[model samples]
Target chain A: MADDQICPKCGAPLPADVAPGHCPKCLMQVGFESQDQAVADPAEAPTAVSGHSGVTWDLDQLASLFPELEIIKQVGIGGMGVVYQARQKQLDRFVAVKLVRPDLCDDPTFSERFTREARAMARLSHPAIINVFDFGQREQFYFFIMEFVDGTNLRQLMQSEGLDATQALAVVPQICEALQYAHDEGIVHRDIKPENILVDTKGRIKIADFGLAKLINPEATDFTLTGAKQVMGTPHYMAPEQLERPLEVDHRADIYSLGVVIYEMLTGELPLGRFSSPSEKVQIDVRLDEVVLRALQKEPEKRYQQVSGIKTDIEAVSASPTGHSPRQSVVPPTVRQAFNNLQYPGYGLYCVVNC
Target chain B: MDDAGFPSPHSGRFATTRWSIVQAAGVQATPNSRHALEELCATYWYPLYAYVRRRGYQADDAQDLTQSFVLSLLERNAVQRADPDRGRFRSFLLGSLNKFLSDETRKQGAQKRGGDRKILSINVDDVENRYQLEPTDDITPEAVFERRWALTVLDAALTRLQGDYERVGKLPLFEALRGHIGADKSTIPNREVAESLSMQEGAVKVAAHRLRQEYRDALRAEIAQTVTNSKELDDELTGLFQTLSGT
Candidate 1:
């Protein structure tokens, strides 16, 4: 029972657990039978931005709530709640306002916990982190006004145009810088996945929802809140310690999740039971395998003690000229400058070679 | 008329389905709508049972909970209480079941209240056997429910296709061509099937094409029964596909 058996009609791998006879992937394609006709109807096209939740607030209603800013439209809906792109009247600049789901606010201690974590998140000011400007409650809805990155998240980027090994290499180091900054501020982003990592049009990484997962659902073990298929945060990128010993989870857990994200970016599959390394799955530098494997170690103590260690290893591989072509060494100058400013003394030499 | 066992797209037979009828009634249940809701419950009960089991209940306890939950849904006319905006029976059922389980947990040991008052004829042993085959990985209970729900939709559609073939006395043809329903024509072994069915290779090709078209229709109709409009149908289809493909 090979899991990698690809379906003939649709090239997606046939799920191994599906009962034998019909390809589940093919059957899923059958489920999309009406999409062809549906796409033809222009009226149905704009429904993508509208919230899928049963209780959706119209633009007029949302506009009334925020008189200071102009509510443009709903941008996204996720586990925490809905995000609307807006413009600050005074600054005349675009910002994203995220309204926390009303159900999550039912807890009496929610506001107190929210303020504490939000203040900590607001303290984290980095080029790679989405900066939280302000947060407050109004009319039964708690909202966070934040800097808007005018580009798609990593998930959309991966889905729309698959990332190459070069693109992946360029992205991981930026993420490491962001994670290291947040860790120094004593903030651990429990939920670190592709969805939270936003890449601007300039190819700069801006990580969103820094500590919102813990603020929303304090009880990490409670899976019941994710009812009706509303994914609070995916467990695929979760480390073993996050699930097994949640009370003892620390910044090291974030390192483990980063390893999973790196694995998925390099190879388009999750690193599930006895999965192969990134180099084995793709045409990546073989030296990178030890970096990913070390970060993904089951024990937090066994993994990289700090996020900077992963960045140092990744930079070392990217700097080496043997495996990849010079074309692959096109590291964005902004990212290279950010790394040079860091405490890594020898990093400037690698930047000279790679850039 | 178009082909044996394949209905024309404009046949109007699928204009109304069980879910659409239930949704249209909207808190005012006609006998017809009630019966439609019951039929849907009967067909999709296994996923709910699997959800309960994955939620860390014993097989016996899970069976009892599922039976009671479905019984209560019909008896209380819970379809009327379903939020119309949700627009999908799958979400409503899962949401209601979660609420029911929470209520049941508060009244612990009240599992015997249903007391063999079975409304749906679910084979306990068969369901448990199927449950055992589920991948024992780190998937969430919601993930299990979602995957099972997707499988149930596909299984229902496949069953309906089989029924259509059986009614037209093309059961053997269906069994032969089922594997190639959504497969490439070049990949399908048309020559072997033509020899076995004592038909021309050209005829086998036509039959395989018709089977694929009919399957798409059957699956669309199956999904349409669960969603309210064409937009929601596409959304549900895409969502379920993502669930299965782990994208």
Candidate 2:
């Protein structure tokens, strides 16, 4: 009878005939699967078919391939490849073995690039980063032996017991430390989402899959491989430049993604299409909104120049007491100076004394 | 599997749906089984009517054909031919209807056969009025049936949710928060609703989230009734979403 109204959730035009008061598409999607299951669509991440021989490997076959380790079982399957938990015979410890998808290795120069990037990843040694033990091409399979994280990922944590403002505050700084460490080593983690961030039982954050994005898909310009329906990285966490001008994306893109992760952790929602500030959505310090908003800035130049800056700002906010009014005069010049001094390791301690 | 004859393992909310009851009854139609089928037919008759109309039938002829087909299905034990293993009610209905339509010998005789036996209480004017608003895109009759079926399923689920809220005397709250059924609550203005209902903003957010969870369970329950088991429920839902979004 009238022009069709648009659905706010999915942006699809609601059918004119059926006035169900809710978006029919989204409603059908709700019936499709629970929120958690839909996020990891099985179609996108198929079970791994090991090697280029088109033969699916059983545990025995996988164990035979890697004689040095006891192949436990398949732990995870991503667009990149499969991850298997195994114990190194010589080292007598658990390690995650990541196999590069055989299809990805079809590129002629893949071996050279993989070796180069894998070395860089191996060189990165930080508590907040998953340690890369060994990487090499074993037969047709390019594998990476990494430190196994014996805990759930950030995505699972957020889905199960949603993070409160306090828990989110603690998690952000650790992510910043890990990201900053990798960034300084001249390796940019093109894909930095909650799924890649692992949290152990002791509540320690470890960022995984550093430089693997570049190693998998060398051309950053082709962000989403829509032809294969294989998303390189979660688009919601991607910076504007990653989607628009992918070639120019630098370490700041990782900062933008970290901003998205922080916002999602705080509010349990993606900051999509004129979203409200995190403080407005949840009970948090109002000043922390500035840090989130700046990191989420559309232009790369406007965001935090370094990943450590996000940590400094978050730490500064955590150091101060809550319920303080948002006034420029409230933050003393000493605290403002601490903001400029990005490399100050004890900025939070300094803020506690001064402001 | 037991003295009851119906599968016993399917317990709790999924124990005995109308389709499952009819499937369990097989060719022998008991009174209880017959009543369950009738109730299901009444709820889902519109999609069949829409499908008939989309297949190039005129208003009066399409109405007669759908009614006659449904009558034959109810009275003649036609569901006996529906494969017991393929337990999806939607697929069985579509297949049986197609078979009935394709039989030229029975088609002419079945038309205007059940003029006095109107078991379903479907409003003719209202049904045609809704059909007129159907998109005139170049979609097949099967696609039309599927999309209409998906809408009908969601409508039934929403109506059930509304009825639940109504019984608890929370219809006003349901009305205010219905728009957020499948939406992210954070993106919506909970404070506005909170002030209007004189509720704490946090309490309103919790209420909204609970409503969404309830709505999801209701929709799942509705879908669960159509398929044979819990496993097929997700597959059926995925199919419904694809059908609706494809158009």
Candidate 3:
């Protein structure tokens, strides 16, 4: 049989041997197989672009390489690849599998870095971190199997149900525990956000996607400059030092991120920089704005020294007599006012800061 | 979208025909029909086996007797013998099974003859592997069987859906939706499935509807695979419904 050419649906280059219809990635389904039924007019041929990247791999192929895994569902298109909800057949449990971008694998160095990080991330065993179990390549697409968390991330959680002080306090320790573990391993988690924190059943927190973590090694100073520092993390959470000087930053940068997480947890708003912006910041209440401002301090030395320290501070404010009442499910009006005062107007005074 | 798409009476909460066919097919077939018989035996095997084991047979003896009893039913069309108008298919199948067990025990010395023809090919090892011994003697065979059957059908439905998704190349979407299917979201009061799938609420609802329909179709197809004739298919389906309802 002749090699299949022309997009199955649109007469463009068909990526591989997919059935003759619309492109699989795009929802286009026409042309190719039987030309008699084809619409010959070029003007009428649907020009719908592929909604998803042209990255597809067979499940059976994946199952062969990762014997323990059974591909469950495709989760979403990520920055680098497509994600799948898979089951570890040997363990009889569910997991999420991320298939790295096929084209990126052609770059040997990038592929090596990606797989090495995935392997290192899989070695990390922590309850709060999304667990990576295994990694392999199947049909040119590199795949990583991770614990399949059955819950929404903090972003969606906050969107529908605004964070409360008790709930906020509850989440801080878990995030810290995860960061502490990763930091101890000498891996600095560059991205920390509500979107990355997955809360599973029983409200257990699991931090996901160590895709941007920087593995520190003094022997490899050049490694930091090689694709590690360029536009890497969420701009809002990046430590100011990372922005100003990327190569010199270290694990403390992650602690700064954890501070931002706690700040968002308390005030329901991301800490502002001299240049922080989110389209929907107005909806966020700066209830504990004073606490948040201190965490977002531009200098790393000025920010909370440790994730544990930040967790302790959040716990202290949560336990304060004049602050939010322990019995109240929602933060009271007086607390909201005090928080706003700390944040608004020409005033710079905040929650009687000691540092 | 309509009721037809819904499981028919043959496919609904109570199905006598399905039970009859299973009961009949179980008893009639010989050794090669073992796999086919094993497959048919899945829905009802545990219950029957548990009951026989509880009735004071040794583990291996219980298994053999259960298989033998099922073979008898197949040879005799024991399911076709079910009169749902007189009593429910659940009662009829259990009662018929009881009668078969008693007759087999009484004719203890008779040669155990099985059918020469094969009905379907089943993975006997997989079927046998699924059964587990009761943890305690306090539980009745009937109760054990009922619970195992319930678990088995759910597992079968899930397996069938998984297979269909893999074949169609939409396994990922199916995986994400599987957790939400038949789940109680009361604890998560504001939780909307659309957020997980990254779709709007309307789209999620449509996706759920299609999933439920496809699941039903897969289930019917699974039930259909276990029988021989169209009438038997209808019968087995009705039995499956009753099994679902615990009637």
**Which candidate gets the maximum lDDT versus the true structure?**
2
Report chain B TM per candidate.
Answer: 0.91, 0.91, 0.57
Clashing pairs in 2: none
lDDT of 3 at B221: 48
Cα-based lDDT at residue B101, candidate 2: 85
For candidate 3 chain A, the 10 contiguous residues with the lowest summed lDDT are: A29-38
DockQ of each: 0.11, 0.14, 0.01
- Choose the strongest candidate by TM-score: 2
The TM-score of candidate 3's chain A against the true chain A comes to: 0.64
Query: Which segments of candidate 1 are over 4 A away from where they belong?
Result: A1-54, A219-232, A324-355, B1-247
DockQ comparison, 1 vs 3, better candidate: 1
- Tens digit of per-residue lDDT, candidate 1, span A33-150: 4322212222211111213223434456678889989876445554466677788998988899988766667669988999998898899999999999999998778889999986
lDDT of each: 0.73, 0.74, 0.52
User: Alpha-carbon error at A349 in model 2, in Å?
Assistant: 42
Candidate 1 chain A: worst 10 consecutive residues by lDDT? A41-50
RMSD of each: 20.9, 16.4, 20.5
Candidates in descending TM-score order = 2, 1, 3
Q: Which lDDT value does model 3 have at B239?
A: 54
Residue-level error in angstroms, candidate 2, position A56: 2.3
